[model samples]
Target chain A: MARVIAREGQERRVDGIGQGDHLCLVYADDAEQRRVVTAYVRAGLSRGERVLYFADARAPREVLGWLRAEGVDPSTALTTGQLSVTTAAVGYLAFGAFDAHAVAQTLQAEVSDALSAGFTGLRVSGEMSWALRDVPGADQLGTYETAVNAVFAGQPASAICQYDARRFSAAALDDTQRRHPGTVELAPLHLNSRLRVTPSFRCGQRMLRVQGTVDHHTIAAFAATLETVLGWPGDVWVDLGELEFIDLAGLRALAQTAARLPAGRRMHLVELAPLLCQVVNLAEFDDISSLTVTARDAA
Target chain B: MTDPAGPRLPSSRRLTHQALIYGSDEEFLAATVPFCLDGVDQGDSLLVITTAGNTDLLREALRDAVNKVEFLASEEWYGTPGSALGACHRVVDQQVAVGEHRRMRVIGEPLWHGRDAVETAEWTRYESAINLAFAACPAWMICPYDTRLVPEAVIADARRTHPELAVGASTRSSPDYVDPAATTGFWERRIAPLPADGDGDAAVLDFDADLAAVRVFVARTAAALGVSPDGVGRLVFSVNEIATNALQHGGAGRLTMRLAGRRLVCDVANPSRRATDWFLGYRPPGPGQERGYGLWAVRQLCRLVEIDTSDGVTTVRLHVDLD
Candidate 1:
């Protein structure tokens, strides 16, 4: 039986990912993509899996260079056929058109080949920027992504579909995220059964995206994440769009963070649920000079 | 003897909890209108919370001076004693922060008609506890009790709760007043015990450290009992806060949950026999303050929260109306 990877609908670090897991890697920029892809390929090679990368925006040579710079020698694996770096033109669009079923079949074939060739599993990651180029039948990207899950089902194979947020529309990103079983997040600042706190820096703004519940049990981790995010220079933003619930202790943590911010810095909380908004307002959090809260737009 | 003008407020820069007992609307105005006008002249922020009819009476009587006085219906203002107190504290805090008002003069007539004996007693305790909750603040609050509308027993309790009484322009120190500090036992009086739990009718869980389980238990049980989604959320939040406090202060706790009529009552009890401050959740924590907000927020979220420290345990019962 194929071993299950990270729990479905939860976030996993690049290294925690395993065979039978299908993940979406949404990168804000090249730095983020390089970090995740490097860790992912390194982990795969170390685990004796056949690792493959279909480079789109970056040349295959550049992708190899990133691995080498990260202290991983890809030349030996390249010679042994355990590592392969190709281009989307030669792999996904080999027939001069995108086909969801064809690609899924190809993926299944790769998994079988890797298993037959004395490898433990097949680990593949593809730069999905090709879908943004208006390729014929490229609109079926979500369909292809969804179909890939079936190929990975009960098979020794895993895939990470990387989408550059800068290149993908918000709707496209959201759709892809929904289709994937799990997302690759930065090694989370905090993760437990009750709450998950992940930090990301985009465009000079540091943000912590909190999901699950934050009550007294998880408040210490949540508070520590706030402290780490607040340590970064400039204003901090917390995205509570995915947050299910936050109690008074969590609110107090936000208030304490705002109180401790240096002069001229503020904390912006956005996409709050209506109930959380009501609590924040009831607690008079708005009276805190360095704090700002924006409720999620009603559905 | 009292000044014909109206009640004379004390000059001390501290809170004064007073009662205004009146028989008619004219008498109510005779005592309140001049009090509000004088507050306006003194640059004090005035907050009048009364019945709609009385609000109209005060508005019509205050005339142009009405704008200076913020009016809120008593029904809306008195959700729970703790929440009402929290709201009043917020108003006073804001006024103090602005530095524009010399004092806060509030004409608060608590809703008395529909309350059961338990609720009336709690509200009465609230009236007395306000003295301690706002001891240092410059606020003069007069709670009016209508002779015709208020039950005689409640009016009698009002004298014990209020330090001063105003009866148609005659202001005097209430002979029956019991100082909150001197009667700390009265303030921490044991709340009525919850009825014995039915075999399987109540969902009970004992929690020592994991507040998350407490939340899940509450959300599930509340929803199972037919609480609306929003109500479930609130009950979970409130219960989690109380449970957190219990674990932190009392070491471990047990939760008993059951539905009484249309209300979902959850009791969180701990082994500690220590007396709980009656004003525990009645005051908001100041900025940068961390320890005092949990219970305050719980009180704001629940319909009514009663903290009882008797029978060798401290029980904080949270009530949420399922309807």
Candidate 2:
């Protein structure tokens, strides 16, 4: 590992995404900086990199437009080109409304395609920041790590790496180890991701503690995580206290699932950021006393 | 109104799916009454299931003909995938028994999805044997005055799945359809307020015809709203589209004059889809793309064009502000 000078006493939290000697992304200002990032992405693609990107924001236009121009229609073909780009705003409006599994299946399908394509480097932009907040799965850094290693398994040394500014709990490290062993962990990538989900376990209740932007990608993960945790034998409490944004999809998912959870299963969401809670109320998810997006800062 | 190439419609001897490509569903039913009476003369049983309560139109259109009605129930949200598959299986089983030599043809362009998918898909999804079975006899369709919304995918998939299936389109058209692109804006500008505050599956609104002319239906609608519409070239592309939804969807298709707040609104109450998409507004032949922007054009034009489709009735209110 190359040692670099630290910025005083500041400890930067980052999500990791690596494939071989290259990394997923690092903060870049313009085309020049992006070139450095693109070089690695291109190299990964050369090695058959399966890249999945959800443009959750607008800034990532240049990168996404390039991919979309390259003929990446993820909805139809089970397999897109080695790379694919999708936008949440467009997705919602395209079908004229929200369809959750349709959106989620898009990624699951992309990842599966990437594995088949044997794609190496996957570069994503847009709401990568918000993806880190509530649903820090594929759209965020967490998924990047899993995908990189899965796609580049048993490849040459230095053929894989992970870099993201979004950090989950150090405890998830244990879960990562227990679930996905042998995948080397890389240092966190430091960038300006809007929202960050710092996961942690409290009193045996698995809490997906969030801190940052709350968008469509993260929202789906929250519901998915809850569904995942329900299969386990513990009372789960999801604390979105530090979250910043919550769109319609996020609010609806939490409300719908919370409404019909079994008696054995109790979900209590605590600490919602102002904007986030309002969406929950608007979508009517908070009406369920079982689920709470209260006002408090935890992260 | 079908050619004599395939089996005649409303044939009682054949207990099978009969699909008729008619001018409209109403026209199909109108022809079906005469056709079924002929079938009755041949000594066979007939069962009619309608999703809409307007079967009275079928009765009235028949000109007082004697026809037996087993039951009339709504076939809208009727079955599931499993049930659909079950129904298809039975339909297929019966088709197989008819003869290994004769072809079985599945007919009718029915609008189907979800709970309605079973029966709809049966008429839609193509199985080789079913196609062969239906190839011998097909459904006789009637719709000289009805507007139907069917998913494009169903047709294509059926064609691809069953290349042997024969389907055709009717040349007749309806007149109630208001082209969303060119006419909506012109309505809001000159038309007045709506009256029927009564609520239900549909909302009935009225507008003045004297203030607005049908010749300016496209330009005036947009001009009245003081807004420029894109693809105004697609306005009222056909008279069939303009009329079908009016009678079939809303119940009637004619210009009405009503007063709302000193404003004379010339409203046309017709059945329109919850969506503004119509076959006529299409750009040549592209689908599910920038072509479906016609409704968006309508939404932008009308001052208060409300679409209320709750029960089964769908009434679209196009308000043209008249001071």
Candidate 3:
């Protein structure tokens, strides 16, 4: 069975990527993105799969040139119809704005074409940096990304959606990661050990008590707790009295999760540090109706 | 057409102005249209200056009512703070020259997306200068900024500069608002110098012609300090942006990284006197526009950043909390 390349040289079984496997690849910049693509494409070619690269931020020629520089003979692959590179307009933005249905149909066609040409399967990768623009249908991107997962269901094609952390907003990156099952986490893995998240049920409300440091590294732990609270029946409260530090990403995670609550359900931030509350106010997170923030000093 | 009994401004001068901080287009349109229509119906001349995207949005929302409004591009009207203040004075003076109305209504959004460091600082100064520039004028100006696009620091400054805040259906006096006179010396104190040696020895690396090598050097140093993998990634990216700016503007520079009081501090020093502004990445970029996102990206990734220039040397210090 063929496998998909995960990182610089790591490969996972085909089951890990096929049958409608959609991967959210988050990169920092052009250099980082190029490194990931080189690995992905080389792995696909070695697996006898037809590869398709959609150029959004860069031109097709530049992508081809980069691929060539990475030791992948894109020209020979193109001549043999084993590799194809096109613009985002052709693949993703078929109708001037990205239509999920159109993109899925195009992917279906590419997959069929690849199989008919004697290739075992298809691998498609697209740069999502274009979505950051004021395109007509850009607001529907979250829906489109979610729909793509279902659109490619049961297909042999393995698709990867690439987002540059530098280009896209932190909110967009967070939303994108949640929409896909498999994610390349941009948050640093080795977190500060002082971080502590204790989830408890108090008076029929889901409460999460966070302590020590809460930055990008440990935001996932808080987010997981929030996910559970968001699904609950009543109100949720996050106690931050013991939190010595919390970065912007951590605060955003709380705000985003609070904003996701169902109507009439609220997320109350109880006992927030004075300085942390000020940062939230500065960022206007306090303006969110679903979230009622009360500073510890005020109380 | 001015009603004797209508929503009155707090100022004794009958001037009503505020900053419209909105997250999306819908919020922007909802808050702006009602305000503009209220002015237009009152028979006041409305001046709307912003980016092309916002101009189109306002026009579409106002539809036939746009004819009564004078819309100017932000770059043309007030590209720089000094120039913008002069233009503002000219607009107020010209309106005062008309004598057709006692009060002129205006909406100025001079700072939006894609501003360099100097432009952001000057524009922020201009925002503060507005209170003085039109201190006694009967002109009421409301500035609209997209929260999704603008930086939080700029938005915070907007609150401090503008005396009022406008939301969906109501406008209220801003509690965070400080007198513009009190904030006059803001630019001078924007960045303060850090101490030479705080706790630990700093790792300094001079970079030129090799960003990748610099990334490796920072990575090794940051890893030794036990920085998180994600923090390391952002540090590398921040250093890259700072280094790129240094190389482009000042030929070559040195980057110093050290842990200070639970914060990883990295300073990029160069031989340029041009100081970067506080609003480097305040606004998010629209698609198809790729440049000018470098420093802004750095601001987004790091916890806090301070840029200073003194004696022909410019330094940008990026902090990432390790605790």
Q: Pull out the clashing pairs in model 3.
A: A133-B287, A188-B230, B149-B283, B149-B284, B150-B282, B151-B282, B281-B296
- Model 1: DockQ vs. true structure: 0.40
Candidate 1, number of clashes? 0
RMSD of 2: 24.2
User: Please, what are the lDDT tens digits per residue for candidate 3 over residues A1-299?
Assistant: 01111112112222345546777776554665676677777777878899988889888888888778977787778999888888877777879887766777677788889889999889988888777877878788898888777656677778878886657765676577667766532222223575766543322234566767654345567667567666656666777877765655577678878888988888888777555575565444665779888777543
Name every residue pair that clashes in candidate 1: none
Query: Quick one: best lDDT, which candidate?
Result: 1
Model 2 regions more than 4 Å off: A1-195, A217-226, A257-261, A274-278, A287-290, A297-299, B1-323
What tens-digit string does per-residue lDDT give for candidate 2 at B1-323? 23212454454233233233334555556455665464455443344444454455556655534454332443531232222223333444444555432322222223353423323433332221232233334232221112344455553443333322212322222222222233343111221124443112222223222112332453444344333332221222111123334543454454443344422333444544553321121111122232222222332233333333333334444443342
In candidate 2, chain A reaches a TM of 0.32
Identify the runs in model 3 with alpha carbons over 4 angstroms from their true place. Answer: A1-299, B1-160, B163-185, B286-290
lDDT of 1 at A246: 83
Segments in model 1 whose C-alpha atoms lie over 4 Å from true places: A1-35, A43-73, A78-184, A201-205, A297-299, B1-12, B168-170, B196-200
Please provide, for model 3 over B146-256, each residue's C-alpha lDDT reduced to its tens digit, 9 standing for 90 to 100. 888889888998898888988875889888876644534354443434454346788889878566667789889988888887677677766776776777788889888
Candidate 3 lands at a TM-score of 0.31
C-alpha RMSD by candidate, in order:
8.1, 24.2, 22.4
Give the per-residue lDDT digits (tens) of candidate 2, residues A1-299. Answer: 11111111111222233432222322212332344334434444545555444455344456544434545333332245655545645532234443444443444454555556555433332233333444413333444444444333443322222212224333443333332323222121211365454333342234455555444335445556445444534344666654554434455556555655766565666665443453344333454655655554433
